[model samples]
Target: MVRIAHIADTHLGFRQYNLDEREHDLYNIIDEIAEKILEERVDIVIHSGDLFDSPRPPAQAYYAFKRFLAKISGRVKFFSVLGDHDTPKRRGMPPQKLFDDEIRVLGLTGGDHQVLRLNGRDVLVAGVSHFSRRYREILVEELKKLDVIAASHQVSVIALHQAVDRFFPFEEVFELRLDDLPRNFKYYAMGHLHARTRASFGKGELAYSGSTEIMRSDEISDWEKHGKGFYVVDLSGDKLDVREVNLEGVRPQLEVRIKYDAFDLELKKLVEFLKTYSGRKSPIAHIIVEGKEVDRQRVQQSLNKALLGKVLYFRSRIIEEPEKEFIELKPGDINISALLKEYLRDEKVAEFGYELFKVLKEGDVEEAKKIADEYFRRMMKIDSEKGVS
Candidate 1:
């Protein structure tokens, strides 16, 4: 049996507020991941990408990484590719070669491929990193020249850090398709998408390990909870099995939509649902109340007080019902906030810049940097705060 661990998007050193505390928590998560691998006794570990939240990780981040790598030395083989966030935007940024041989980093150059031998079977891994804004072929053409099928009789897996498919809005940013892959690999382990999923395309299995941590309120809201972790893959000869090892407990997620007339009754129902499900094993909770008649602040206050700190986030929207059908190109056709979102979605550059502007306008320099990072993240399609294709 060839046991392998697949993890992605660790996003170490992701400090939003309370730098010391957040940084500590971030490293703790990394420790948790490494611990899982050591306990399982996996033969090799593959980190799809996004090891660091920032391209130029803080000294603390590097120190933590080095320490963790030292702990796992000689016990398990580890491999990582450059994620969009891990690679600095400026040209001539240093490569992972600067790190000691104990840490093996792959895909620093535009086109790079790696092959590992596990129990005498060759596991071929190929990848492409975000070098710029323009979306180009994911180097599948170059990968085919390697002839993966002939290299191994035990089993073979391809590691890539690109979007799942082309239907996503940011597909134009990192466009990749299932058909573009080499036909003979047994599994295509992918990253850059923060959802746990498996798809059978061509002749292999395509899988995303998802983000190991929740980076945004939108992600928590969309996924509806927080129990982030990695995928453990077990390979026996030519067969493969995979499972998710969740570090955090399961948190309940609730979304309620009520009409203006039914506010009183629905509000009670929503609260009842929140209270009943909020007592789960998970430490985090997310509740979203959206409708035409929602009282955003009041709902937030009620929910916040009721759940206290257990509620990771609460979002409520107020939208008035339309009296008649909306006329095209007419005023008051769409809700104010809805209209703003629609307008912002079209202009990519301005939309990103404004996200940065929002933090600056609020006079939070550190926060402004975080949001600015997100802007570049959005443009790169690396942030799945929106959704997967």
Candidate 2:
């Protein structure tokens, strides 16, 4: 009865909200997982991908992972693959090879297929790293080869860091379809998606271990609903028995959306929510206000006063509604460009607002700032010519 712990998307070194404590939380959670592994005496640990948040992790992150491996050395074997974040920008360079000889890293620079003879049983593991659209063809070719190798083994598991069809709601970054997967694999251990999920794939099962920490605000609701954890797969029998082992020390996150008119009421409610929070540690709060022309300063001050120390971090996003007065414009009565120019004049950036707007629309904020600087310089020149302060 081989017991394997499946964890993924650790994303160590991710400093969410630029908070160093958040990075520390990641390291602590990994230690907690290691402790659990020791308690269970698991046969192996399988990390799907994203061990680090970036290709070049900070020194602290590297040390944290090194310490984790050291804690579990000689007790359990670790098998891992590289996710998009772990892959180096330089071509043909493998990041996993930097690890100590005690660990085995795969799916980069070949060696994607491993056969472990444990307790007189052959456990086959096939891995594939993250691949972009430009390398989709290469990924397909590798999967075809892996399919042949998996077919020859009795117990085969496929590990990949790519989006599976229908598994995630949005597929804008999807790399492969469900049908692209090879058949007859006993289990499919997946990564890349932060939400925990499980689904049947022909005769086998597919599961995502989910990210260990809350990386984004959008993931807060799902994490609150499903909780965050890893999976323990009991592969002693013909059928896989997967059990979820919830982790402690996960930072709590909350999102409160309210209309502009109800800002005060919602603020009070948020205060009450914080007061009733049962988490051992402070949570992260995101307050989103929607309505016309909110007093951003006043609202932010109130939130801060009410939520001070109740959360590890507090941020507010105010979405101003489009002016109702401008919604009734008649077709062809007013030129769009002319109106924009007038608006820019009112905003006091008329000189370069048009250029800035064009660049901003393309999501180049830095270029937009450069245009604004040039406009400022031109204004300074005009002011000097007129001898004005």
Q: Which candidate is the best by lDDT?
A: 2
Give the CA lDDT, 0 to 100, for residue 249 in model 2: 77
- TM-score of each candidate? 0.70, 0.80
lDDT of 1 at 75: 92
lDDT of 1 at 286: 39
Alpha-carbon local distance difference test for all models: 0.62, 0.80
Residue 274, model 2: lDDT of 83
Regions of candidate 1 where Cα sits further than 4 Å from its true position: 16-25, 94-98, 131-135, 147-154, 166-174, 221-227, 249-287, 291-316, 322-389
Candidate 2 colliding pairs, count: 0
Candidate 2 local distance difference test against the native: 0.80
Q: What value does the lDDT take at residue 350 in candidate 1? A: 52
What's the CA error at residue 99 for candidate 2, in Å? 1.7
RMSD of 1: 9.0
Clashes of each: 1, 0
Error of 2 at 387 (Å): 47
Model 2: runs farther than 4 Å from truth? 92-95, 169-171, 321-389
